[model samples]
Target chain A: MSNEVVLKFHKVQKKFGDFTALKDVSFEVKKGEFFALLGPNGAGKTTLINCLCGLTDRTSGEIAVLGVDPEKDPVHTKLSLGIVEQEVNFDPFFTPMEILRLRRGLFGLPADDAYLEWILEKLSLTDKKDVRARQLSGGMKRRLMIAKALAHDPPILILDEPTAGVDVDLRNSLYDFLRELRTQKQKTIVLTTHYLEEAELLADRVAIQNLGETIICDTTKNLLGKKNRTLVIETCEDEEVRVEIDNNSLDLESIVANYPHVKNLRIHEPKLEEVFLEFTKNPKS
Target chain B: MNFKRYSTLAWKECYRFLKVWTQTLISPVIIAVMYFAVFGGALGSRITEINGIPYALFIVPGLVLLQSTTNAFMNPSSSLIIMKYSGTLSDLLLPPLSALEKTLGYMTGGIVRGLLVSTLIFAVAAVFTGKIVPHDWGVFLLMLFLANGIFTLLGTILGIWAKTFDHISGFSTFVITPMGFLGAIFYSLEMLPPLAQKLSLFNPFFYLADGLRYGFLGIAEVDVKYSLIASGVIFLLLFAANFWAFRTGWRLKL
Candidate 1:
């Protein structure tokens, strides 16, 4: 939303013994941007997140959160960042409220009961606030993780595979909440999800990583614009029959106009999943 | 150091054990009572005095130290190992906490559990033996504090290094328990043969038990000064090890 950069990476590399998790990775996230990072499993998306939050030290390269290098000043850099990890990992004994309160305290933030209550309500966790985390359903635990991350009102939020196991209704609700946070609160967000549709719906800018290297970074509009379209034609003879063809072919329009059996015809735009496969299948593309 | 973050972590550690008082606090007290009843009561009449201290009183400090060290070691070790395996350790790592702050926070839990168990055993021993007063109050407190520090550090290290629950329990069962028992807790070094007495000097638990015995009953098989020095050196070394583990994020970081 703004020209100010919230995060920047310069040729960052991470190695685990002989295996390299991230190699020469460089990217920048602007302030108030809804950025989506797409990667296959073991593509080093979590590794990048870990580097930004100082959970692990990068083997080589430079990273800046806000204006501070995370490796040099991790605590200070972390003050402005919130993270919702891929796994649902809460202290089993603690309730949702207690977990949020504890997280806020860890950030040295003063108690804001009203804000906490509001977060619980927004996440649909008010009814389950008193229940222990271990007793909560998977969806509820995911919501609780989001609540905990947002408790301290961080300027930037990074969510990793947030909706991996979530149902459609809950995932839709999370999308609405995240959209609200981006548009209304103007919080910078970076999300990594296996669901390409989620990224398609919310992301302003998208980056796809493969084999520990970022293969593509561009505006969502530009990336989607490059996708191929599909033409679907429905016909009724003795029974209904469907014919599919590439929308870009010259014969597509002629076939619809000339075919007497054609009852309905539609052109479908390329989905994010198709584009994702295209980009990941051939990283150079 | 951010006091708020440190205190929050420390409080969490304390709260974890307190929340499971039956397992963390009560079980250790029960075990200490059994030790006192079996070893101190049954074996006391056979041996009247150990180095001028009553046999019951002599074994009291050793039992206290033994329980203190074991619980102290187990508390942080299990907490960390569970967090690691369960993937909850990221909860602490993601926060804006320095490595030192994290270490101190976890150490507080180990220290509290260790001291709590030791105090309970001391109270129970006082009732049984009718000896409530320590020979030297200052030395007793110092020795107790140092012993807790040593084991808590060890626990913190193992907690960071361990990848599985069995690894943590294995260390406790195979290393800590054997060292505590063989460290002259029940029998004096004089009771061992010459070679065994020399080997006993190498056991750190012996120095811990002897140091505590000196504090409680004013008698020690090893010199109190030497024991204190050994405990202090071990404490510093363990502290360094824990600090290194935290700072480097060994096994903790992805």
Candidate 2:
């Protein structure tokens, strides 16, 4: 609320033995921003999340969450953070409600009957609260993960693959909930997901990473707006569509001269995936 | 966070185990009683007694120590490992809980489980045999702590390093079980050859078993008082080991 950054990593580097998990990765999540870190598997997206959350130590550089360093004050700093890990960690022996209560108790929070009831209601898990975690469907288990993360009402939520492998309808529902979180609840959301469309739909900003480095980062509009700059057109003509090689490429006369049906030419626009792939094609560079 | 809340967390973990009494609570008890019935009834008749007490009585503390240590270690280590496996660890790690809070929560859970198994076995022993009195409170508590602490440390390491289900079970079978038997759980170190007797000193579990037996029977093959110092040293060492395991993140981060 105070125009302060909720989380920041300045040139953060994390290495394990000879392998670098994250290198020169730096970014800032402003207060109340719904930011997304988009990357393929093992692209150091989760590593960045762990380092910020203080689950893993950064090899070098600095990190701050809510003005407190995760290393120096892991306890205080984590107070306002919530994490939804990619894998579900529900105990087979525990019911979803008990798991929630146990998680809340770990943070030393008092038992709030009303609040607990509200959360159960919000997640539509009231009926199955008494059911063992193992019995819950996969989707239900994932929801329990979110419920656990939000148990303490942390101001920031770190969602790792929040909707991976989920059905489209459920994914859309999650999106609606997350959008509400950003707008109405004012929770700062940092999402790392493989689905680019989800990022395009919900993220206020998006950062693409490859080989432990951020290849490109900008507002979602700016990144996707690149698609508008270029257009891809399809025509029935099977001619090897080599238009021409000239500096004045957009000159209408010159463009049409090489291919008489250039008037029917389709301009190909770059998609977010194309731009992303292009950036990471030569990651070292 | 208040200790009361931490206590609640620990109780929650305890309740988790208790809820499924068949696996966590009942299985260990059945295993111990089987060991006692088979090892003690069949073989104990021939041995009669070890040192001064009845043979069954002599091994009771060792079995108690074994169940206690295993539970103490498994409850937290397994919980964490399973969390890491299922991705639940982030729930606590991402919360306001500090490393200390986490350590306390997990260990308390383990300790509760240990005590439950210990008490259950103790009750069974009381009903089955009338020899259940401690020689020294200090040594008994010390043995209780070290047996729990050492395995807790070992479990922490195993939890961190395990990548699959097989890895954890492998540690229990190859490392922990062998160590338990070697710790003189069912026999006296005096019966071993001089070389083996010398080697037995290396197993910390031996001293815990001996110390705990000494507490109950008013005498043990090893010096009851000395076990206190030994157990304390073991506790300190394992504490540091687990602290390092947690600090380094070991195989926890992927």
Candidate 3:
């Protein structure tokens, strides 16, 4: 268990005055594992990430990333981690390429021109690298954000709302780049996204949080499997309905007899979106 | 943790102000000269010398202090606000740099801008009226740095608190400008009644201006020692506040 742990939260909590943004929540990201901190808005997915990044202080408990305390050893911890914030803040005065150059200098990391070119090329930001950040479109800005986070080449990458307000092509391109990072760079990714399908596609484990508590933490299959055996039926007068039922409670014969128009009966794997909704509905862990 | 990173960031910040000199650096210097030429030159001649220095010379130090204060405060404050507004501030914050590094980076920009404007005003003042103050390079530099440091902190705090463009300007107009005018910048605190002079002692900017004037003219309405101690104390307090805000990820990152 210790060998695989990349990040561990021991009952971490955060409170803004009276409102607890994150309850006594704890979770782990295994080494090199693609993980997701999934939740709805204000559900505390970003709150947990903020605590890990030292952007927000935790009211209770401890957080260790890469064997360093996030609060006490933020510099060392930050060296091993990269975070893409939910909100965007770029230097309007500097061009995209200049920003990356400045960031590289700030980190005291030597410029690997080859890697820089490769990232810019892959993210489709090469052309606009010369243009100031303010001139770029929203999606372009998001793409440049990812590129900046990637520039340091940290072992852990945390993307918060990475694909927000992005066009489909750019989203696909970014995903392809991330998938490459996950596979080739040995980079552990903590993806906080509203798109469940993206999580299902990339995250090795998905943790759904609600009201500051983690409601579910398991592999994508195991979590999605619990809500399988959905029953979609067409009743009398061409009436149609859908239901997700437990396999134990489902009687195929009874279902078919009750609704004869449900002729195209078949079993399909559960979608991650359905399970996410159910996970969010319950607040208490 | 590494001090070199702060140096690098600070260098970058300095370069930024210099690169956009026309706006951040030059405009303020030109404005400072214009104020001296129009007000100090035209009106100061009619005015008699005070405290063994010409009226024009007497007013130059405080006016320069005024420019440095505004520039120093505005440089860092506007830097943070621009990053917040234009969505690019993340460039510096997300890295391994310590909070002190980031804080120093922004503060250094303000310091440089303030010093540059202050120097330009000094040159223009020398041409407009000989040796604006007697001479004390060491104390002059000290008071200028202290004033810049204090107002830079003020600007940074205002920037953090401000959510919109007008918010920053509003603070500058309603608070900073009023404080500058009333801090005995153009008038001697000694001219005020006993109660008014006592009240002006409470103004930190007054100490800043008085201490700076003492360096140039060797005369001040208040004790130079008291002005030095007050300005020094304000600088340290503001530095602590700025560093704390930086460490807490205050509104800078959020």
Better of 2 and 3 by TM-score: 3
Query: Where is model 1 chain B poorest over a 10-residue stretch in terms of lDDT?
Result: B90-99
- DockQ order, best first, reads 1, 2, 3
Tens-digit lDDT string for candidate 2 (A98-133): 888877877778777577777777666889999888
Return the TM-score for candidate 3, rounded to 2 decimals: 0.86
Q: Which predicted model would earn the best TM-score?
A: 1
Q: Which residue pairs in candidate 3 collide?
A: A89-B87, A89-B88, A89-B89, A90-B87, A90-B88, A91-B88
lDDT of each: 0.88, 0.76, 0.81
Candidate 3: tens digits of C-alpha lDDT, residues A56-170: 6789998898777977776788788888888876776788887777777788787677787788898888889888778999998898888888777889999999998998887
Model 3's DockQ score: 0.47
Q: What is the lDDT of candidate 2?
A: 0.76
lDDT of 1 by residue, B1-254 (tens): 88999898888888888889899888878998998888878988888988788888889998998888888998888889888878888887888887788888888888989999998999999988998889889878989989998899899899888888888899999999999999999999999999999999999999989998988889888789999999999988888888888888898887
| Candidate 3 chain A lowest-lDDT run of ten | A260-269
lDDT of 2 at B139: 66
